[model samples]
Target: MFFKRGMLVTQAILLNMVQLLTVLLLAPLVKGWINRSNALFQSRRGPSVWQPYYDIFKLLRKDSVIPEQASWIFTFAPYIYFTVPLVVALLIPVLTTFPLFMAFMGDMLGGGFILSLGGFFLVLAALDTGSAFCGLGSSRARFVSFMAEPVLMLVFFTVSLVAQSTIPYIVNQAFAGPALILAPSHILVVLAFFLVVLAEIGRIPVDNPATHQEPSMIDEGRTMEHSGRHLGLLRWGADMKLFVLLTIWLNVLVTPWGLVGSAAPLAVALAITALLGKMAVAAFLIAFIEGCFAKLRLLRIAEYLGAAFVISLLAVITYTMGI
Candidate 1:
């Protein structure tokens, strides 16, 4: 009984901190893992697993060069670019309801909507750099955000409609009650959530995180100007973002069981396993996607994200009708 109480909200806070560090720290490892995976798929010898860490460290130690046209905003932009995602992602629940700012969510729908503010600022900062590439990429990023964000909100709305509230914790509870996974509504929500994962991660068919090709290169284009420690942080932040994004995606299913009561230990272990398992599958799926497809025309971006929006709408409808 004493042990149980010890693991209350306080533990949640501690655990949240740990989880955040895991995201921040393990991001490079995750990137390396993806690269390793991609190489194997292509039958190449591949880079070392620790290569990303080496690159980040080397970058951090290098001197930065500023462009003549660049304002202080150009230098300042990287910090903002890196920090906002960290803050927004820090707001997400992980391992359980344990987060430094779990309260920020207020509820799932509200949190989902609020997180976009960070994306908005990052894109704006990209444009502030004033480089031709930065301008083009930032404009593209904003357009992509515009196209993808509605679908994201609509997908979250699916959960809200089902639980009759948008609180992720509450939604988890509602689904935990009975006849959980068997619920078709949950399946639809998961499918919708998967698309949000693709959109937010800028994965295949949405945006390629790997390439910096002409015309189609969006995020990388804006980021081209960032170098030295600034670039290091941005790359690290992107890796951390994948972790955070994966956590949110996993929460859609794992939270349903809640994280206390007789099932606490099992729930915790299983949730971790589920997260790792999901991330494993997610990594492969993303690679498969990237490997299978070529880049699309810049103008066609809207149609791709629009399809996701339509699916999210379907998810919302599925929840509302409770089919």
Candidate 2:
């Protein structure tokens, strides 16, 4: 019995490593595909779909330049920024619904806190640099985050109300049934979460990832001073963040159908493939929306987020009323 338990632990460790590596490697590919889709939407031939991977490679080989005024926070921020999303990736149901090694780390609330930690460090890193652009970007990011996080928590709460657990895998399993999928509360929460995704990922009508202008930047602004390997880590971390969030949106909230429930090799492989296909569909839809909508003014962003909050509240009300 002891030997059997040891083997089970080993298998769990291996599965966790596999899930981590898959997210790290595939994150850039998702970003590249989105950029390519955006380019196609504009009738202009964009850079290669593999451009993000190439960019990361090039940055890795180059040297990072630090501002003389920067402190240790600036130097260490990239690692912190990069590591936080990795933690989040592990917590989420990426390749399987079965809990891996770190499955007990926390639930949906813990995942949100981890993400917030990364964002907080990023803001501190920007402030440490004392660059005008970085400061401006940090302020804007904080403002948006202030309005967005509450709605996000409310959305999570609504899901927890139905699932009766804050754990993501349990939440996914709970909502996987056809009955929950068609519920009015579930539909409202999904819509609210979708809006949150737009704001969180810096997509259209929220913030533009493609723009570098001082007036229009948010996430990019925080990294304006970073270059070479530091920039690579930050950008890769951003990609990972995007991938993790999108996986949650698609696999947990929307479909929740293809995730593997067993430890069988074939089941795991098929689950990964299903996740990739779903991600591709999501990337295309995001690109289409980006092409169709213009960026909202910074002040107007509050209204956008406010609408999301209202929708989330309605979701809770719908659940309570059995609507």
Best by lDDT: 2
Error of 1 at 255 (Å): 8.0
| Residue pairs that clash (backbone atoms under 3 angstroms), model 2 | none
lDDT of 1 at 27: 66
What TM-score, computed on C-alpha atoms, does each candidate reach? 0.84, 0.98
Tens-place lDDT digits, model 2, residues 260-306: 88878888889888988998999999999999999999999999999
Give Cα distance to truth, residue 298, candidate 2, Å: 0.4
Clashes found in each candidate (C-alpha, N, C closer than 3 A): 1, 0
